[model samples]
Target chain A: MTEILFYSLSIIAIATSLLMIFHKNAMYSVLFLLACFFSIAGLFVMLNAQFLAVVHIIVYAGAIMVLFLYVIMFLNMSTPITIRKSKLVMFAAVLTGLMMAFLLVVSVWQTQAFGQHPEIVDQNIGLAKTLGKVLFNEYLIPFELTSILFISSMVGVVIFNKKEVEDE
Target chain B: MNELINLKDQLRIIPLEHYVFLCIILFSIGVMGVLLRRNMIIVFLSIELMLNSINLLAVTFSVYHNDASGQAFVFFVMVVAAAEVAVGLAMLVLIFRNIKSVDINALNHLKW
Candidate 1:
């Protein structure tokens, strides 16, 4: 059952991402990306990262996607007019990405024996309270610093929008 | 609770190789989008895809090793990603306002 679920979810994730790449309309592409994000959340759940799975949906599909849609709409960008790079550039991009993917596949296949075989993960690892403990205990410095980073980003946003403040 | 463990056991039946390959393929798609697309928003979206793929890989290993630290790091990745996309889109908005377009190719004024 898990195998079937993993296979289907992965296929959904891959297909939606492909649609995002090929869609000419930015809105449609964004929508496809949202589907891809949700499918990834499902994969996370399968991986026993239940907390990350929920947070993934809340952050990526819920908050970030809304922001993406808002910006795309606000800008009112229509279909891009084929910002035509040469065929060589397109071929190069495809070739390089495919080469990287092939390399990754070959390496992953060869290195499978190095790691111990998979087993049942601990339930405590994936829940919020368990992660909360680790976050506050082992990762306290980075946890606190994330807040500082968040604050700086907020300030950066305000600074960037300063022109609009002046205009209004 | 026993049933849940059974499910987790079943999850392990799917080889880790499949997970790694899936992530790499998705990551490659992201790379392709970033390299080929001229639209800044799509490029940003592709970047998020790449990050998501990495987060997936991290969580996979975390679970396979019976560890929690990797999942915690995934949370951090999401937080930083949110901040990045927010600031990046805001800057994109400012650029659009000035140049009246979002095509990245249009921003060549800095070139002498």
Candidate 2:
């Protein structure tokens, strides 16, 4: 059952993500990316990280993607912008990505450290209560620091969007 | 106890390697998206995809090691990603206001 769920979700995620990347229209790409995020959330649930899954949906699909759509609409990108890149650059970019993937896969495959452990120690570590405890206790400092980061980023946004008053 | 066992059994059905490979594919797709797309928004979307793939890997390892730290770290990553998108979009809007284009190539010359 879990196998079925995993495979289906993985397929959906990869397909939608590829569609999101290759789609010409920015609006369609955003929608496709939204679908990809949903599938990733499903995968998170299958991995027993229910809380992370929920938060992923809320932060990513809810907040970020909406921001993306708003920006896209705000820019009024009705006409698809044409980017004329030479075919060689496109080929090199694809080759670079493939090489990176190949290297990562090879490295991961060679590392036997993670291969020996098939047994999960605690199945409930992903539960919110446990995660919350860990967050508030051991991760307390970093958790609080994120608020500072948020404040700074918020300030940065406001400042960046501030109107420039011209001197007469 | 029974539910815990069931959860373990369900998780065991899929190996950790599978998740790793899945993340790798997703990450590669993200890299390609960033590389191949000229639209600044799509590039940002691709970056999000890459971050998410890493988050999934972290959660997989966290579960494998019975550690909640990975999930906590993923939480921090999401926070950072959120803040990044906000600022990035704001900058993007500013750029658009100046040049009226989001094509990455449009800003090739910084003097614009």
Candidate 3:
């Protein structure tokens, strides 16, 4: 049963990701990418990280994709038509993807998958409570630092995206 | 529920190598998008895809090790990804304001 769930969701992820790439319209790409996120979230759930799954949907499919669509619309009021790359460039990109895939898989596969894990996950380490404890305890410093990063990035956005009409 | 526990047991039946391969393919596809696509937004999205692929690997390892640190890192990844989109889109807006197109090729010359 889990196998069925895993394979199906992976297929959905793969298909949507490809469509996200091949689609010319930026809007279509955004929409397809949303599908990809949803499937990835499903995978997360299957992996027993339910909290991260919900967070994934909220952040990626909800917030980030909306931002992408907004930017796409804001950039050009009309529909966005992507300019095609040269055939040679396209071939090179495919070749690079293939080569990188081969190298990464061969190297990683050589390493044993991981340390011994119980056959059954049997624990709720993925639960929000467990994760929160870790975040607020051992990783408290990095957790606080993340907030600083968020603030700086917000300020950077405001500065960079300030409308220019006021300057005129 | 008993069924839920049983389902998790089924998950254990699957080995970790399968996930590694899946992530490898997904990450490669992301790299393909980043290399092949010219639109700045698509490139940004591709970068997100790559990040997601890495997050999958991280979470998988965490699950295998029964550690919460991996999940904590996932939180950080999400935070960073969010901040990046905010600033990146802002830059995109600024670029569009200065030059009317979002095509990376058109913006190639530094003077423009």
Candidate 4:
């Protein structure tokens, strides 16, 4: 059952991600990207990461996607004529992909013997309570710093837009 | 026949390998998107895909270990992802306003 679910969700995730890249319209691409993000969030749920799944939907689908759509609308970008990559860059990208694949294979092979095989994921472990304890206990500093980071980003956005308005 | 039945029963459980495989597929798609697309926003979207793929893996491991800490980290990641998209898209908007396009290939003015 989980295997079937994994494959089906994987197909949706991959297909939407492809559409996101190939779509000519920036609006359409972002929309497809939202679908991709949501499908990934579904995969998270199947992995018993329900908290992350919710956060994925809230953050990526809700917040990030909206920002992208707003930028698209604000720019009022007409359909892109063409977005091209240079041959040299394309070659480099392919080479990098192959190298990364090789490295991944090597690392997995090296670590295979040392690591214990993982069991079935725990299903009853997710909900907010467990997450809260861990966040407030082990990862307290990073949690606090994430807020500071978000505030700085908000400040940056204001500064950038303000500069734009001033120039105009 | 009993052994076969027991084996089938065990197979019904969701294994960690399936999650790992899904993560690999998503990560590859993201890599392809980042490498092939010239639009900066799409590139960022692809980056998000890659991040989400890793998050999926993290969550899978967390569950396998019966620990919630991994999910907690994912929350932080999502927060950063939101901030990243906000700032990234804003920059893209400013760029489009000035240049009248979102193609990264045309960004040669800052190449000095």
Candidate 5:
């Protein structure tokens, strides 16, 4: 059962992400990416990261994708005119991506430690209660720092979007 | 009978290599999206996809090692990703307002 779930979710994730990249329509790409995010969330659940799965859905699928759709509509770029790049550039991009993937896979294959599956020591490690304890106790500083980051980002967004005053 | 097989045992049914390979595939697709697409919005989406793949890898390792800290780290990553998208989209909006286009090619004045 676990194997079936894992394979199905991974297939959905890979297929939707591929569609997201290949689809010419910006709106369709956004929707396909949303599907990809949902599949990833499912995988998170399968891995027992239940809290992270919920948060992933809420943040990526719920908030981020909505923001993307809004921007697409705001810019009126549903069907963007494709500026055709030369065949050479397209080939180079695909080649680079493939090379990167090959290098990563080779590195992983070389690591003998990765072949040994480690047993999960704590069954409840993914639970929110356990994670919250670790966050508040061990990671308190970084957690607070994230709030600072958010505030700064919010201020930056406001400044960037603020209307410029023109002198008459 | 199902209660006899705990969640941990069920999770162990899938090998770690499978998760790693899945992340690799997702990350590669994201890289290709950024390189192949000219639309700034699509590029941003690609970046998000890359971040999501990393997040999944982190969570997978966290579960494998039974470590709460990795999960906590994933939380922080998500927070940062959200802030990044907010600022990035705001900037994209500003750029669109000024240039009237979101194509990366349109901003090639510095490409001398």
Candidate 6:
């Protein structure tokens, strides 16, 4: 049953992700991206990472995609009819993508080592408490730094947005 | 045939590899979108797709090892993603205001 569920959701995710890439219409691509995110979140649930599943839905599906949609809608931009009007840009994009993919494959092939973790947690264990304890205890500084990073990013956005307005 | 089914069953039993492979495919698709798409918003959506793919892998590894730490990392990822979206959308809006288009090609004006 779990296998079936995993395969089904995985298929959904892959399919929508493909659509997200290939769709000519930007809005349709965003919508497909949302579907892909939702399906991945569902997969997270099947993996027994309930906390991750919930957060995935809220963050990607609920917040990020919506923000993309809002910006697209506010901008009222149309999809570019010719994606590759310039041969140079097209070649660059394809070459970069291929190079990155090659690098990723080589790295994965080279570093196939995985840590041997004892399966003590199990599917029944709730992740939130354990995650919180470790995050606040062991990885405290990094966690706080991440928060600061977010705050600075927010400020940067405000400054940029304000600058754009002033220029107008 | 019987042995094949037994092996298939064993392989398909946990579906660990299936999740990982699916995530890889999804991540590549997202990468292709980010690379090939001209629209900035769609590119951003593709980035979110890539992030979600990583999140899927993280959860899968967490479950495979029965560790809660992976899921916890996913939580921080989500927090960062939310903040990222907020900032990204605002920037997109500003960019749109200046250029009236969200095409990546147009972003070259600031390349200097």
Specify the highest-TM-score model's number: 5
TM-score of 4: 0.85
How do these models rank on lDDT, best leading?
2, 1, 5, 3, 4, 6
Query: Interface-residue RMSD per candidate?
Result: 1.8, 1.8, 1.9, 4.1, 1.9, 4.7
**What DockQ results do all the predictions give, each relative to the true complex?**
0.68, 0.69, 0.67, 0.46, 0.70, 0.41
Q: TM-score order of candidates, best first? A: 5, 2, 1, 3, 4, 6
For model 3, which pairs clash? none
Q: Which run of 10 residues does model 1 chain A get worst, by summed lDDT?
A: A112-121
The alpha-carbon deviation from the true structure for residue A94 of candidate 1, after best TM-score superposition, in angstroms, is 1.1
- Candidate 3's docking class is medium
- Per-residue alpha-carbon lDDT of candidate 5 for residues B55-112, written as tens digits (9 for 90 to 100): 9999988877777888898999999999999999998988888898888989988999
lDDT of 1 by residue, A123-163 (tens): 66888898999989999999999999989999999998996
List fnat, each candidate: 0.69, 0.77, 0.68, 0.62, 0.78, 0.57
Instruction: Give per-residue CA lDDT, model 4, range A29-85, as digits (tens).
Output: 888888888888877666545666787787777778887787767777646745455
DockQ ranking, high to low:
5, 2, 1, 3, 4, 6
Kindly indicate the candidate among 2 and 6 with the higher TM-score.
Answer: 2
lDDT of 6 by residue, A1-168 (tens): 555666788788778877777677887877887887788777666555566677777767777777777666676664444565777876787677667656665555555454333434353543577667877887788799888988898899889877866877
> Which tens-of-lDDT digit does each residue in A39-72 have in candidate 3?
8888888778899999999999889999998877
What's the distance in Å from true for residue A52, model 6?
1.2
User: Whose DockQ is greatest here?
Assistant: 5
Docking class of 2: medium
Model 2 regions more than 4 Å off: A118-120, A165-168, B1-5, B110-112
**Lowest-scoring 10 consecutive residues by lDDT in candidate 6 chain B?**
B3-12
lDDT of 4 by residue, B1-112 (tens): 3422232232346555556766776777678768877888778888988888888878777766777887887787778878888888878888888887778878998798
Backbone clash pairs for candidate 5 read none
Kindly report which residue pairs in candidate 4 clash with one another. none
Chain A TM-score, prediction 2: 0.92
Cα lDDT, all candidates: 0.87, 0.88, 0.84, 0.74, 0.86, 0.70
